[model samples]
Target: MPATIRDVAKAAGVTIGTVSRALNNYSDVNCHTRERILRVAQELGYRPNQMARSLSSKHSKNIALVLSGFLEDTMLNDFETMLMKGIYQFAFEHGIDIAMYVINSRTQKEKSYEQLCYEHNIAGAILFGLKTNDPYCEALAASHRPCVTIDTEVRGPCISNVTLDDVTAFDELTQYLIDRGHRKIVLVHGRKNAMVSMERLVGAYQAFTRNGLTLTHDSIIYTNFLREEAVAGVGAYFRTHTPDSATAFLCMSDMLAIGTIEALKSLGYRVPDDYSVVGYDGLEVANYTDPKITTVDQNIKEKGYEAAHLLYDMLNGIRPAQKLVLPHTLVERESVKNLNELSN
Candidate 1:
């Protein structure tokens, strides 16, 4: 027979109410006592029936993780894989199950979100790819349901969010290039509607202005973060402008950088020797490039881990912060070269 709460209480030498409080992570429970109860429960292999617990506590025992679009995009797919791995690992340990939802413009308008929530009986949600002006965000807030956004912003009511300091990171990266004596820099940005893309573009411009440099409209190009798009965009930009026009390229993602690098090689442009490149997202593939990409490491796996843990806390009645910002670092690699030395 499966171990019961009463059995755990007896094993821990605590009252049933005390066991309940400890299991629920109530603040009133003594830390030591709670630890003891947890230890005892583990020793006896006590697995709480999530369904029964939900029925008793008026919770749905289901949480939703919503992505921005379909899994066709390589960058998004990679992020989803890493994020889901972390989320599932944490959820498994905590006896929670995740219901994943992929929301696009079509689904958002087709009653899919509501149908998903109802079908899964989700008590809370974790949303990714929230646009700045997303109307669904407002509806989720108005519903008074606990939700968290990953790599996006959620405002008003009981919503929480986690994102990187994208602007600061981009600024620091661009400044690093400038400090290394790169005067002519090109930017390959992602979708315009993405908050991250807008912030990064703003940071790039700000970095140039702060250093008494000017950015022409032709200095920046936009792509949909697709490999083919990256290749075509960079190739087209270079075809129109001379190699001396820009000494370096700052890509919004490593995948884009890979595409740009391939395009450059096809045009007889040697990386770092003729042009330097930097990318964001320190994916494993970044290192595999001919000259390993210099990038901003956002620790994607950790982001997912933190998101899952935050949701778990919210489910247990712990009110976490409204906004969580993860830290990022610059990974210097061979792809970025000092233009001053090359010029000499």
Candidate 2:
């Protein structure tokens, strides 16, 4: 038989109410006492009654991790791996259970978000891969449930979001190329629906505008963050424009950069030596590449960690709906060659 709360309370020499308060993370409970109660409860195998807790104080200790449209065939990349690690780290430390709720446009049409959350026993959600321009985001904004999105921008009464400042980071990154005297640049961008991609495009535009350069329609290649798409897009772009028509490729993702490098190699060209290249998302693989990638280190893991924190804060009313932008750094490496005539 499972130990009751009363049994654990007795073992810890605390009142039943005190045990309850500690378990619920009430501010009034002493930290030491709370730790003792938790230890005692664990020792006795005390499991809180979920149904009863939900009825009395609303949904308790359960969150839904929302994922949509991630690549199913490939292994998880370093950015994704670290992001989830950070989120689970917080959940484990807080004793909160996580349930994955993967949905897409079709699923939303079949069942409403509220119904889905109810069926999953979800108290709150950390959402990923949502689009700002999609209709579902409008519904999410109106739902007023605690939802935190990663990289997607959806504003609502109860929505909190966490992402890096894409505009500034990408602006600085694009400018990095121009400063090195790269006038002929090709922008390898992402899908039109994603707001991050749109914002990053804005950053690129700003850099081009300030430098009296232009991102012509013909020079932009669109991909869906797929390496294969990057390869095809780059290949197709070069077919229309001569190999020397562009001196550099600025990619929106490291995966795309890796693919771009592969595409270049297939064409008898070398990175930096022939056409300079750079990428975003400072993945570990970026460093291990033959010549390390010049990319934006956007602190991807911290984005997930803070997404968890924002949702937790909203759930507990510690803070209202918040938007947190973590810091980003431009890591320049061997993937780019200085074309500014500073060559020895």
Candidate 3:
């Protein structure tokens, strides 16, 4: 038989009410006392009755992690996987229950965000992969249910948007290229529907404008956030433009940058010698690549942790800032070559 809350209270030498508050994660509980109670509860094998807790408290302590339009065949990449790890760890530590759902276009037509939340008794949600024009995004923007999105901006009564500082990171990265004497830079961007891609494009453009450089529309290449797409896009670009035409390629993702490098190698061109390259979302795989990749590290795990905490705050009636832009850093690797070094 499982130990009861009374047993946990006795073991911790605290009142039943104190044990209850601590178990429920009440902010007012003393930190030391809460820790003690949790430790005692774990030792005593005390599990809170979810139904009873829900009945006593008006709000459900459940959160849903929704991944929108995730393809079944596609492998779960590092970003989403790391984000999920953070959210799962946070939820486990805070005693908040979490559920996951993958919604496709068909599901979007059949169920609304509110309905899903209601059906699952979810207090809030951490959402991902939503495009600006998605039907679910429209509903999420209109709904008052507390929702936190990664890299996508949505504003509502209880919505919180969390992501890395894309604009600043990209701007700094582009400026780095310009400082390295890269005059002709190619921008390999993600799909147009992704807001993050658009923000990155804006930042890259700003860097060029501030540096007194002109970028034509032809300098931009679009990809569907796929390595294969990047290979095709870069390959097509080289077919028309000379292999050495551009001094550098700034890709929106590490995969794209790796793909660009692979494409260049296939054409008998070398990286940082024939053309420098930089990538975003500094994934671990980038480090394993030959020459490695220079990229903006977005701290994917931290994004997930913060997103969960933000939703927890909202659930507790604390209105966090409308948008939280996490810090990003430029991870310098061997992919980019300084022309100044060549001159020297």
Candidate 4:
């Protein structure tokens, strides 16, 4: 076993308290006793407990990245992986200790947001995947600690929100379809109480209205942001309303688009030729299909980077806290067809 503080104290012929004070460089300890403790600690290969040490300090340097999903599901997705990479990179570069915690909606019923922070000894937090109905969201708004929420529209006095313009992105996407002569488009969306979903719905409506087209309420399908759920939900949806129901499917996520393609294929349909598709989030898997999906690259990694920066700045008092919107680009691939040319 590695050396503990007890081992060092024994070797140095001092109490554990004296050994701890000497190792932590407390001034009250005599210089001779501190030197002896440190030398004995080195000889015994004693390393301080980081978690214990953090708890002891008044100003803990530890922060947490609060992700909202099961640990397995969170790591499996490309968006989450890329986001974590950006967050971890920032923490590493800044000499910050980052703790990762997953608190799904169900877990929030048992533990409050503040309780999680308290248990983890977190000084600040970067949160992601909180929907509108989360119970902790109310507490989060009232929190005095530094926090940055990623990709959500929720606002608070101290909480910084990092996201791209979801409304504008979806607006341009719908307009892109309308420009290409694609009318009667189906909008595949995420769950209810999702702020982003609401924003995207607004964008789609705005685009359709501006072009003198009506986006009827029946045209939207809610799938709750999972591929398997999307597959079953979309499959059942189109079964009731045939492929001719819409010429294109404008999905709020790549997973939804991919699932739509699968659901359509199982019913003996081809993408773009039979029904055009456009997805949000530029995931690599979206490109693996026979016809690559057109998508919006919303800079998810940069959102993580900005979230870290925002929370750190708030904690350090380096800058005032506010919403940070990052840039996004539309990637046009082989998914959406040019219906105008076909009409000619």
Q: Which tens-of-lDDT digit does each residue in 1-344 have in candidate 1?
A: 87898999999999999988777667788867876786687678665677345443434467888886655475544666777787788888877778787777655644434334543466678888766666576566655567788876767566778789999999988998998899899888887788889888888889999999998888888887777788999889977997789989989888888888998898999998888999997787888889999999988888887888887787678875488899998999999888667567
User: lDDT values of the candidates?
Assistant: 0.79, 0.83, 0.83, 0.82
Give the candidates in order of lDDT, highest first.
3, 2, 4, 1
Cα RMSD of all models vs. native, in order, equals 12.5, 11.8, 12.5, 10.4
Query: Could you tell me how far off, in angstroms, the CA of residue 266 lies in candidate 3 after the best superposition?
Result: 1.4
Clashing pairs in 3: none
Task: Give the TM-scores of the predictions, in the order they appear.
Answer: 0.79, 0.81, 0.80, 0.82
Clashes of each: 0, 0, 0, 0
Off by over 4 Å in 1: 1-59, 72-76
Tens digits of per-residue lDDT, candidate 2, 157-205, equal 8888899999999999999999998999999997788888999999999
Best by lDDT: 3
Q: Rank the candidates by TM-score, best first.
A: 4, 2, 3, 1
- lDDT string for model 3 (99-191, tens) is 899987677755556556644566688999888887778878777678899999987777899987788889999999999989899999887
> How close to the true structure is residue 259 of candidate 4, measured as C-alpha lDDT?
83
RMSD of 2: 11.8
Candidate 3 local Cα displacement, residue 199, angstroms: 0.6
Superior by TM-score: candidate 2 or candidate 4: 4
Between candidates 1 and 4, name the one with more favorable TM-score. Answer: 4
Runs of candidate 2 with Cα error greater than 4 angstroms are: 1-61, 71-75, 342-344
Q: Which residues of candidate 4, in runs, are more than 4 Å off? A: 1-59, 71-75
TM-score of 4: 0.82
